[model samples]
Target: MPDSPRLHRAKAGRFVTFQFMPSLNQLLAAHAPLLVLDAASTRIQVGWLAPGSAHWAASFAEAGIGLFECLDQLQTRPEAAGAFVFCDGPGSILGVRTVAMMLRAWLVLRSRPVFAYHSLLLLAHARRDPALTVIADARRDSWHCAAIGAPLRRVPTAELPVRLAMPEGFRTWSTAPADLERIPYSLAELLPATHDADIFRAIDEPDAFLHEEPSYATWSPQIHRAP
Candidate 1:
């Protein structure tokens, strides 16, 4: 396939043994490096974080690419085997599943740990806004809704709840462009900013990391829940 216009990479760096996974406590306790992958968008993103920062280093983003392609490039990173963080989602089902499955395989084959971040939580963190609402297309005339620091909720478009919805003066972010214009939300792609690598930097609780299989939300009746 022809390379997409958005394909990019920053200056690379040496890999470290420190990683985050299985638990945030282990991450902090081990002071390991972190790898974050966001494959739920039209464009895929790969980034890394140092031991104690929320900033990214040598992060890369590209459109018209698949998860394997992103992993192909990531394989060059010295930290490829480190603990990984993923954006488990309510976005593209295939995209998220492929990435998650590949990472799961890596966990078995390489013994690397895996952690998950809610798609909404990632968007809120990227926006650096504590009060914004996250909206992802849920099909069926409904949408998946999540506020910063809150759990996920499904809401109908026509009957949007005023209180649970984006509050006045608060920004609304989404991964789908159509959702941006159709739902009137802002674009907050999952690519990490230069200053932060690990999205889980500030989290200290061990339970913050996932131990079971990651899951993505869907509206299709035929599709079984992700495991």
Candidate 2:
């Protein structure tokens, strides 16, 4: 990206590989890269963390943030050597185009490698024997859902029903979106601010399916009883 600090690639650079079916863990040896955002129909989440720090810096707002912002903000704000972004799909013809433009923009703005992965796949990547069904309500009287078993297939959010609930076999894990609402970082504090900030905000998307939130961060085996 444009504001990047120059550094040569690590000669011994390698990525940690983990098996997703049963659990997810990175190789302790892998350096942490800045994880940009999870733009979804329900909520927009942003975060970054220092490699191996185990601590997280995060924020949350409305969904569709990707459709508006230049995306270089993710690179510029945190100033990471590399960036990874996860987004729901298959978006409109315009959404797909946005992804393409954003990737190129990040490359130029950050002067580093920028990668885009399907948000569902990234989420599913952490699941062992992951069965992901991209569901979203089309409104009207009809809705759509696409169930997938990863390593088996990839599903897009637009094609799925927005309000559709997940199956029983799956577990949930998300940094509380509400927690992000509490950290009041102003737009002026965003380093390089944007005038067209509406896209990254929330939307009135599909909400046709039925699902429940499973306990993620707050639950513990010792203190919480399983239903």
TM-scores for all candidates? 0.54, 0.39
lDDT of each: 0.48, 0.32
Q: Find the candidate with the highest TM-score and give its number.
A: 1
lDDT of 1 by residue, 1-227 (tens): 13333222211432223333223434433334566666555556665455445433221243224544554655545245356766666565555676666666665655554566656555554556555566666666666776656666776776554433221112234333232422211222343231243434322221222323579887756857899
Candidate 2 residue lDDT tens string, 1-227: 12223222233543322222111112112224545443332333454534333222323322335433423444445345344433434222233344445445655665433333343333232222223343222233222333334221323333332323332212224221121112122212221222111112111121211223446676556766789
Candidate 1 lDDT (Cα, 0 to 1): 0.48
Question: What's the CA error at residue 150 for candidate 1, in Å?
Answer: 2.0
Q: How much does candidate 2 score in TM-score?
A: 0.39
Point out where model 1 deviates above 4 Å: 1-31, 52-65, 74-80, 128-131, 161-227
Off by over 4 Å in 2: 1-9, 12-31, 54-78, 88-103, 122-132, 137-227
Predicted structure 2: lDDT:
0.32
Candidate 2 local lDDT, residue 140: 39
